[model samples]
Target: MKKIFTILLLSGSLLVSGCSDWLDVLPKDKQSTDMYWESSEDVEAILAQGYSRLRTCVPYIINWGELRGSSVIVPGRGTKTGLIQNFQVLPSTSTVQWGTFYQVIGMANAVLKYAPTVMDKDASYYESRMNSHLTEAYFLRGLSYLYLVRNFREVPLITEPYVDDAMPNDVAKSSETEILELIRSDVHAALATNAAKETFDGTWATKGRATKWALYALMAETCLWAEDYEECVTYADYLINATAAMRPVFMSTPGQWFNMFYPGNSNESIFEIQYDETNYAQGSGSPSKVFPYGTDVTIDSYMYSEPMTLRLIDEYTQHRGDEISRTYYGSFAGTAYANYPDNGIIWKYSGMGVADREAVRTILDANYIIYRMADVMLMKAEALIRIGGSANWTEALAIINQIRERSELNPRSEVSADNINEATEEMLLEMLLDERDMEFAAEGKRWYDLLRYGKQQNFKYKARFKAIIMENNLTAENKWLSSVLDNDNAWYLPIPAEDIFNNSLLTQNPYYE
Candidate 1:
């Protein structure tokens, strides 16, 4: 799903496909890009195409080998079979190497370049509609780059539409600092123009597109990763205190919070990749690759592939993944074999059918939300601790407890919003990372969690992970598969080779060599 949809945008993104109005201007440009930019219907086509770009998180995280929030403990996919299988990775065949992100950057470049032009020419109603479309472009672009820099370590920083511009010719990799600046700058641009929050008149537009809070979420993430803790606190503040109607509260239970990823029904979600089960066609976007752990779901259906591990299931059960633990979950993990008492198949595929290990996950209706109310509250808590210091345990612990209570656990006796003392920096860091783990378990936060700690203190997670893996039953060979750090290279992924070849002016990423 990540490789496929990330590239499909240049093919169908804000590029505007099925529109007759755009066809009128067709001959002047292409039949499509031309016909869609001159009229009201043209605005709709761009919007439909723009909204079509709401990319999900499954592709970015799952394929890269981060596990989801299933309470399941298995070797990461990359460690088990995807990236670490051979002593190497696929080059041309791997879209994630570079192509996927470029496509997203391209789509954003084109839409931001064109959406407003059409709005200026169209009617007032068209202008209003295009306003949201422009914002969506901004949000989507930031998302693409966020993953690009995180995974590849750095990227080609494309802000404008791709062209053979003779500017710097400097396609050299930017530092994480520079990349983060790009993200914050883009987010600021979106917030200035996309003042479209609480437009939720029970319309798909509000749900399908990014809200102002979405920008704030991006802002929080950008600052948090950069370790600008106080700034992260401020951004989270915008989301919480902005609108009176939109109260920010983290979901209290794991089922209600985590199950939101099933298909629809994610009220806490700020920006999500909306999927439609009926449109499982390969040409249309379907995320069959990332879902289905234990069920009848087959890889043959909708081009799905990937198998679950007994290891993952056992871990979940060990962690108390039972009906009593999930009072809100309809089908607890224990109910594995309603049909066959002992067979626990793929866990939860978002697609319609449960076939086999290779079935296509032919459903895009399952939305992947990038930000939610829960994330904001939790991030605020982390930032509060960073700013207020160990003495600020009460402020930070309140946020941590909200996430803990959801998992049916009690907060540490020492920390709370009211009766708290101080925390050791290590204790606060551990608490923040641990709470972040539960809050963003399956959402791709784990990889970054490792990186955040790894980059600081000279990549110390190598020793910690080595120690944990030994007790965690991660065999010596398997430990390496999880993308764990090595003393030699720090475990930062190499930049995709293709990116460097295509742009001669760009230098190869620093650490890969």
Candidate 2:
């Protein structure tokens, strides 16, 4: 909590540049409190900083979102993600620290609180522009809280910026319901702004910053997580029927699909954390470093050293014969099944071509995509299935088939829509889950998708969730891991011990305590 109050410094150069150069402005000095909120560019710098801080959370996102789920093999004991993979997470584990997210929230709060005053000081800072900046602030804060509530379940809801050391730091955790309500409110507020247009004039700003499409995507995702099926479907349709200029569509060919990663900000990207190797170098924190692809790359330098599980690999091979664009030499790399143990590298963020291993990316600045077209399509399909009806079932199947066709797989044998029942619903739900698994593998979404499924209707799919774990696990401690997953509270991460010690009002999750 004390860390949240630390003031973010800005450079004088930041006030004179345009949006494109905003990220280049590094912090050089703390601003005078009376003189800072006088220009629109000052607002842009803090918004850019919000994005910069969000990029720092990518490593944690990938680790927490994938390692705990059944996709990759476990890391060695001394590696950073090993504890998470082994289900040995403690409050002291480094990955569970939520400080970076708070930093993002703090930047957003500063913008929301002070950006309005800019209009009073500068004649050029119009109301429309101020509203646009405010919209982005709400979107960033809402998006940060969404990650927090998902991982921690209950967390201290900090909205106002802490400007000085004298501010109180002992805020207590809010209930999950309260946190979710706030997220919903923020999304709605953002949507009401004039700046919430779907596409910005520049492609980079459209994808890198929050747009109307991004706001709708956030609402759809939040509604799905909250179990508001009707609302989820409605918000999803807003994106599904977005204007042609901004609407994201699937890549028509396999080679083009790789564009979503390599040069990023593809037609399909709704929102992604922008990283330019020229100005914002990824250093050792790049996705290429973590999921490196060659024999020459040393394992000790990377945090995760395992290949995709055979279970996930077979999912592609068995269903779509020779998944040229999405599996094997595509989504992951290896000559053949025999070479998988040492060579099944995650190729999405590292490879320049689907089939060519030699075409590896030299620059390590692949944008971390938060949402894309396929993700929204699948989300809408899931919500429709949850709503449950003959009409809804038929629509969901059509959507699923569209995705399947894009992946080069045959359409699933159709269930009679008129005879829709619990059995057909369950079968279709499984198909949707598998499709998501194949579509978003190693993209930091597998674990959250499983959690949403398992927690639906108060653990209705709990047995199925355990079955997935049992089927994919090949470790010596499989039984122990299964036992740990039996406790519902065990699914979420514990609040960090340092945060608890720093703020006496903070409490550990009961499962950890």
Candidate 3:
């Protein structure tokens, strides 16, 4: 059973229970924090609430990762999403708030605080179980903070729950380096425990919970962000070399990849936000709500959003012709576009065999993906290229070839050692980046992949983004896009003005000011 993200029954408890006052006033309507952690089940319920908070953050995560990516072509020029994609958001704009993430972090902190207390109170509450709970808590907090740092760049480091004014409320933002260090500490603590135990309470915790395997994947991803390629290789190797049972397998073929989305939580999934149609009231929040489908979309007629751009659609078209793209990007009447290239949309997250827009309800239970094996394998390839020099070129090419072969295509002729050795570092990096773009299309990995490249002393994403958008008539003259390309600070989002207003000591991101 997928135990990680089972429909949470404890949200009501979260609202009514435990220190509603946040200080000394214990809950009157529900269990107090002291009473809540009395059992592992209770701890599970609280952690479920934290997961519940994460569900709310899914769309925000997409926005931060994909909107400004300039991949999607939005027809609604004045729309909020369009503005964000063009990098025109203002500090006063009520977008991309970090408040919800802090809520998740806060609940995670509560877990860390009380799980140990339960162990002290009951002899049956074994140390291993307590450590497991603590490990999950740290994973949740670390993951949340990583998202925050990625989007906002700098945010207050709140490790403890807010109890009273005696604790600082108006904390200033910390450097990305400092935030990353804290993330490292949390994941490291999680690794220190027996979380790799893989199963808990007889449920497949590997799929649902933060198994040691999942934490290792997260650590590798985190290390990549920190530009610690060696550490990335270390953790990637740990996961790659895990027992055959633990190792994430590439789906049988490129065709099976589409199945990963239709019926998610596949063997390849390292970690994903679980959704149950029978249990989850609002399945996957119907990504259609965010990406948008035409009002009258039906199975017979095409229904896609404008923001999903012709560029992305063309890329999808190319994939269809070459390898394993047909299942992913289908045409309504053998024509790819519902309305030509302008209204093209990625149908992966839309639903399964959706007969109509309303049929989306039938397949709403989508697992918000985090890491998968194919993506990780390519990541390791990039790490090898970055750390091991020319000797590693052949190995990296072999890894990339594995993904290509999975798609039923022969390896690129140019990826051989001689070609790789002769290619400039920029050329090799660009090749890797483009490969990621194709493999991870619509997975929300593209923008971050670009940003990761840009973060390395020299800026390449600016040129790449500019070149891509220049092809799109919609963004050809976009002034906001021009500003973002010219200025480094514009890359990170502005702290919502409301955030700055509420926290007097908090400063705005320098670019916004």
Candidate 4:
């Protein structure tokens, strides 16, 4: 089932075949939405298509989520990524489009729209299976909106299926708050159906499909974004106490932690997009070629994109005083670069072998882990601290220490049940932020962490990002990039010209306009 869906999903993701109203086509294979809604198998195929289309956005997700505020530098001057890294993104950058994500939303909406008709057509056949598929659809729609709201801020919220008679192209943007509410409602519907991870067939399906575990992780994440810290802690606590089978245990050993990316679908993964080399002919958009790690000096030729900043590498290895820890530095390497002697390579999701004797080869079947145990653990710690009070702070410290211990970093001492008494809330938050950068570097998370932290600290994140860009510049051409960063709304990329010209209802992000 995993291999079959992986193959079909990649192909279907391209055509998203049956979505007639959205594409304004006859759908060459005659899989038109109206005609295709006649069977449960048809519904399953559409759901599979949704998953396939999602894989298309893996690179965009990483690029948009991490590149903007990250400590990465794209060595070449004219590259699209270099423009993004320098905060000089224009409406024309090819990376500005959001069509792929909306395609996923359209397919998911089709499942939600037609699944009931599927149940009505063959009640006996659908009785046990309908809810599981419906739950998956709801979770996916909610997940799509979560991505949109985080990146785009306010996006059009479309729930109905875009059938032949009802295609609306001029829909206006919904408020971010409104989108969050709809997301919460969709997640609740998914939970009400109560689908278990084991119910999904295939080794990859168990972790790939939307389970109660994934739903709760989404809830905790959404609540954290909404600033409902109490609710965030509640959901995080549920995940922490969840059974091992439902919620995979966090892999603590260094070897397991590093291997988690290559032979993915690990016990630590909550939900990850499945990518198999044989099925995905379009290629996996493997980061290995970009964030490459090897004994070969040839690494310098193709791996210049997003080389980790010396500051980030320094943070990862630096322990107490000026002493550097070899354990933490094990995940990074100094790849030879003609321009710089100390260029750092991120091995986190490089798809390289973790074992000492395993041959280091570039891998294409690198799966993207969207949510994992370590991420939630750190989130739980942040939530507990955000809820305030002395007890919460102490508990939060212990949680952070747990993650640090797993990473083999020095753990904090629990001083008189207060941890660091001199530590203000800002100091505690900074500790958690630094730990996140160390643990999740090159995993497309650091930029968002900086945004969230910046929001918490009076927009200070903007100033920090500007400083990094200015300090790292080698030429005066990109110096003008710092001036654009002065506006608070500059944090979000402008709506692409393609989207704006196509729909008059859509407005460019104000700062960009």
- TM-scores, all models, native as reference: 0.74, 0.92, 0.84, 0.84
Question: Candidate 3, which segments miss by more than 4 Å at Cα?
Answer: 1-35, 200-205, 244-246, 284-323, 326-339, 353-361, 458-473, 476-479
In Å, residue 507's CA in model 4 sits off its true spot by 1.2
Q: Residue 30 of model 1: what lDDT?
A: 28
Any idea what lDDT model 2 has?
0.76
TM-score of 1: 0.74
Tens-place lDDT per residue, model 1, 475-495, is: 135545445334323344455
Q: How accurate locally is residue 295 in candidate 3, as Cα lDDT from 0 to 100? A: 34
Q: In model 3, how large is the Cα lDDT of residue 100?
A: 71
Give all candidates' CA lDDT scores.
0.51, 0.76, 0.64, 0.65
Consecutive 10-residue window with the lowest summed lDDT within model 2: 298-307
Best by TM-score: 2
Worst lDDT run of 10 residues, candidate 1, spans 299-308
Off by over 4 Å in 2: 15-20, 295-323, 334-337, 414-422
lDDT tens string, model 2, 393-479?
A: 889988887876665667766464455554466788888887787788778888888889889888999989877765654442778
Clashing residue pairs in candidate 2 are none
Models ranked on lDDT: 2, 4, 3, 1
Query: Which of 2 and 4 is the better model by TM-score?
Result: 2
Residue 62 displacement in candidate 1 (angstroms): 2.0
lDDT of 4 by residue, 1-513 (tens): 011111111113223323221122112352555555666666777777687677777777777766664444445455676566556678888876777777778778877878788776765646557777778888788888888888778877888766553466676789989999998888888777555344355547767777777888888888887877888888777788876555667777655666567677888888887666544333355454445564353312322133344544554554543222222333445423323423444555553554432345445666778888888888888887777778888888888877776655567542425445666676677678767766776667766776676564356455665665455454225547567667657777777777677667978888878
- Give the alpha carbon lDDT tens digit for every residue of 1-513 in model 3: 111112222323222222111111122343445445566656666676676677677777776776565544354445565566667778766556677788778768878877788776777878887788788788889889889888888988887665333456577889999998898888888878655456443122456667776788888888888888889888888877777654566675665665566567777888776665544345644354454433343322222234334434554444523444432332222233446542455456655643342234344566677788887788888887777577776777788777767655556665576666676656666678767766665566766777777766456456765555443335436665665667778778898787677677789888889
